[model samples]
Target chain A: MHFTSEPRLADGVLEREFTLGEIPGILWTPESASASAPVPLVLLGHPPLGLHKMYPRLVARAQRAAADGFAAATIELPGSGERPRSATADQARADLRRAREAGEPVDEEIVDRLVLPLVDKSVPEWQDALDALLSLPEIEGPVGYSGGVISIGIRLAVVEPRISAAVLFAGTVVPRALFEEARQVTIPLHVLLQWDDEANDRQAALALFDAFGSKEKTLHANMGGHTGVPQFAGDAAARFLARHLK
Target chain B: MHFTSEPRLADGVLEREFTLGEIPGILWTPESASASAPVPLVLLGHPPLGLHKMYPRLVARAQRAAADGFAAATIELPGSGERPRSATADQARADLRRAREAGEPVDEEIVDRLVLPLVDKSVPEWQDALDALLSLPEIEGPVGYSGGVISIGIRLAVVEPRISAAVLFAGTVVPRALFEEARQVTIPLHVLLQWDDEANDRQAALALFDAFGSKEKTLHANMGGHTGVPQFAGDAAARFLARHLK
Candidate 1:
């Protein structure tokens, strides 16, 4: 699991078309890696608010992971993130169904049931795209997802054993029970928080960290409102991935 | 329209409940008033975050207006300021329909077509509540509505003849073409904007003001971002209302 700084594909990152059940996703792969070696991959999620396009820092985090020799991909959720906005949640659900059908290599049961309902609940489709991307073949075991407002995805990581690690940033942990379940996760968990966040998403992250009860957990404080993945966090995430994977 | 201070309603502001269509709203009316005949009113509206209960500043603004010899009411949008989370746009629309059906003496057609759709679009429902409140018998002519993110409400005022004067606080304005059909409003308009507002809602306000083609339009700059109605703004709004209405 030693990630080399060399390209596994062409460039440090390569965008390849991937399917999660029926969902189509573009995978960002490190060109320097070996196919035989098990690689740690992450599915970076985004919120609705059309803020998906605004997440340059999260995209860069993926690049940093690739540069550190981990396979990383930023997937646009169905009907979101360079995808057209669906007039209704039903239409978005339909698109999600198609994506689940197409994206076979990943866990469709999670995508169809728990994940879709969460996405339909107005959690934002960009988050769903991350889930779809993680289902791809190039990124199977030991995955992580990151977003400033992605609490549900954290919950997903807790329930799905496939997720070996998770990074929750300025996001809330909901239903309380989700935190209890997340505590059962045998993988490393990290959260980046801002005290200035109005929604107290940072507070929720702390609660989750408390529940997980593992010394492997880390919390980084950055100044700003509840949006954007700070570049300052990129190096920390890289080191954490390297430690956990290799 | 000269707004000045009045006596306390009770120990503080009196919470008034009114039905717009079928939707129920809690209006806080500040008892502080200057014994003036037929006092002008300014209806303060809340955003989708919740009901007026959560917005202390908006309630305070209404109280300040009432103290300035103007009757002020901050009405909670239905289904908002009520629960843990604000109601969705569609829920607000259903409430709008109920408000109209209840025969609350509001502009039902406007509530049904324009205002409801706008609220459903997440533009904010306080303007519609203001519209209904302005049409009430307790309110005198030359009434206005003010708030941050006050663009849609401004557009509603531009089209609806009932709104005689408006003081936008750190507000943004929608495109003039949306309000084009009802162009010739004789009332005065004051837009107070901040430099650090999201996406420069102030600049958007300026663009709308420029397109308005009215000499009476005023744009003032403040030092805050997405601020609640400031105390000093009460005097300024009072002055504007007095100049236009008296």
Candidate 2:
């Protein structure tokens, strides 16, 4: 990993941007953390709109995690942020446009094309990020994952034993294979669903939640649109993460 | 609707080929069917491989319906049978090949492009065919739908009140929107699922089944690949159609 900027101190938190191989990411650690007494880590799943678009939420969530004595981080998902556009991404954009214009549901295939590569590329990058973050004296195990780009969260929760718990956002589409894989997830999960999300398939979201084999899974459904998550819901999710990580 | 050939008589059954506007179709009527004593009608959802490829299944299904004293019919789905190939179909084929080669799920966009137009075109066409068939004194209401291309089945179940019952094959993918629309369906439904279908998304199929609003729906899951549905399952589905249509 290559640090792109000097660490900045603010509000008792240390913040820095870095590139882990080809993946861009941001890391936030509470200033009070030390090698002898490490804090649990939380990896945030960046929404498809990229980190810049979601900066405020990312910062807020990370800050909340820091406030709760945990380190938080987020990586740029493939096809988002500063990554160069590829043919597949272009096709996915066109497909989205056509589906929207037609008032049709986005094709599952289009969704698979858009998300699977990100899951394939991002999961390993996240594992690497976890490795680097955990190597720091101030960041410890008993990790938690939070946010959208849900396929990544599902993959990480399944494959990365370090992610002890997950708070999954349901605004994104879940591929069928992911649903199959979800049955293998045995960790605690806190899934947030905006019940009236205009851009989401509510049934698919419910189905994915049902597919999780985790014995400790909770569905926090709120009445709103895709971004209409209430503040309390976030707090509740953070509390769940805190309970598991701590 | 224009009949392209004379109705042929065989084993107490009558068969003929016809065209509805630009679409080609086939109709079968039991000899016992007459103006004074009309028989219930069944519209078959021809599979994607075209009527020629599905001819045996269609004939057998129609024959079973006929023996059960119902008129049965099927039209070539758009992009299937002898329909001229288009750029969209070619792109979808290429996309499917790429997805399969990569051991990835085919993007929902490719599926939408490949199947949605067919769904759009076929539903109204099937409605029209229903109109023409019902107009014949030998065919009557309390209709049944059998087989698939599942999107068409979901649409027909939702839009056409003439269809009182359906036997839906779960071998195809269900688009997210269809799951929402499925909630409006109230007809008695018998869904056939090949539990281990190699190409089918089992979770999606289950989700779709769960989304059906029909209070009288039954899921008949068999163990096998897409075509592994056994003879007994078909007979059971026919029995279901018989129970509702007769």
Candidate 3:
């Protein structure tokens, strides 16, 4: 199933949708053409707290990237993101399954239109977005990615070849039962794990990091608890992107 | 007048007090080694809400540092690190007058410490602590320091000759009308500023950093709104200390 929507402007940011595989995602772009050149694209995958608008820093990072010659875009997954368009629980479950399999999730939330689904098995949804992203115009190339709380999103970004760099803030991992594909990915990965992340979530992140046998992986253990996309994270992400993408 | 307190332990973390000229401070240290080897000391200075218990990650940082052959501490400015020891309004005001030269308005709510008689302002409290620290049989020659929220503490660390390195997390400045001593410091300073810091605090930090004027200054604009210490500041602080001290 494919879903699409007309691009809308909230405040000044642009919100649009495109198809990735069989799923669709809301694309958040900076309202202004502030980039000095064809900037590196930052694909932001947010968490599923319904407070997608709380990503002021993400928006700010995008603006900073624009200021620093980088383009930024945020994608909403199925069952969350732009508008809640889920037909039923079965549809939600099916969307989740597809996301896990295809690496692209569906989006069906109506709030903020810029947030991500919070689940841990939406790899397919992410892939769908990645596929769609490659098809977008004026997006530049060689993407840098970041996410808050969404472990699956981090995993997707890390494993996906198109993602050259990634900063996972308070990341977690999918249970082995969910995705048995836990191996080392070659992409540069920076995991900013909050010391006081959710007990289970912390375990998940540790396990995932342990499973990731990449030599380039760096873990920054933060003192503050689970702060999603913390402002400090923006600078850190920028540094990571600079190191990996540039 | 110099204020001092014997080193004590709270929750197994080392705690002490000292006078910086006329200002008093309550310092908290992690329960690590006091061996002859120089250890990294992270001085945590809380927000204007006055000093509360040290944040958990800070304690953890201390623990990690201790494990990594470093010592960590948190200093409560007499005006605020500990909640219960703040001076009364009249005594505080009197101390401010006696130590602050002449007419100066102190924010009692933000900086109220247990009132005390005025002490001489010429004596450097941080230098005094260094003297005492060097005097300790267990302390070695190399020393490192970092602070947060309390701009004065960071200044104290920066200007002192013994402090080999410093990281000031979410620091603020003293109004020139109150105390303008931060500008004299030249140290390897790393300033961590919260993105959403409170009114004038961000500006204060920028001003302080500009004053410190270290060639190695690194400014990290974090995502948290006025929270002291970003999620990953400890790791960065540790790296900073390691670089400068060892």
Top model number, TM-score: 2
**What is each predicted model's overall lDDT from 0 to 1?**
0.53, 0.84, 0.53
Q: List candidate 2 segments past 4 Å from native.
A: A1-246
Query: Model 2 Cα displacement at A153 (Å)?
Result: 40
lDDT score of residue A88 within candidate 1: 59
Q: Ten-residue segment with the worst summed lDDT in candidate 2 chain A?
A: A215-224
* Model 2 lDDT per residue over B20-71, tens place: 8888889999999999999999898867788899988888888998999988
Q: Per-residue lDDT of A61-174 in model 2, one digit per residue for the tens?
A: 889999999999988877777876567867876897789889997888998887788789779988999998888778888899998788899999899998899999888777
lDDT of 2 at A190: 79
What's model 2's TM-score?
Answer: 0.51
Tens-place lDDT digits, model 1, residues A53-158: 6446555666777776677655445445555555554554455556557863333343244334544443343345545544445654566665544445555565
- Please give the range of 10 consecutive residues that has the lowest summed lDDT in model 3 chain B: B114-123
Model 3 agreement with the true structure over B1-246: per-residue lDDT tens digits: 243777666656665665545454544444655564445454444443443455564556665555556555444444444434434644644565554454444454324342111111212544565665555544554666666444455445545666666676644435442234555555666666664555335445555555654545555544445554444555665666666766
Which wins on lDDT, candidate 1 or candidate 3?
Answer: 3
RMSD to native for every prediction?
Answer: 19.5, 19.0, 18.2
For lDDT, the strongest prediction is 2
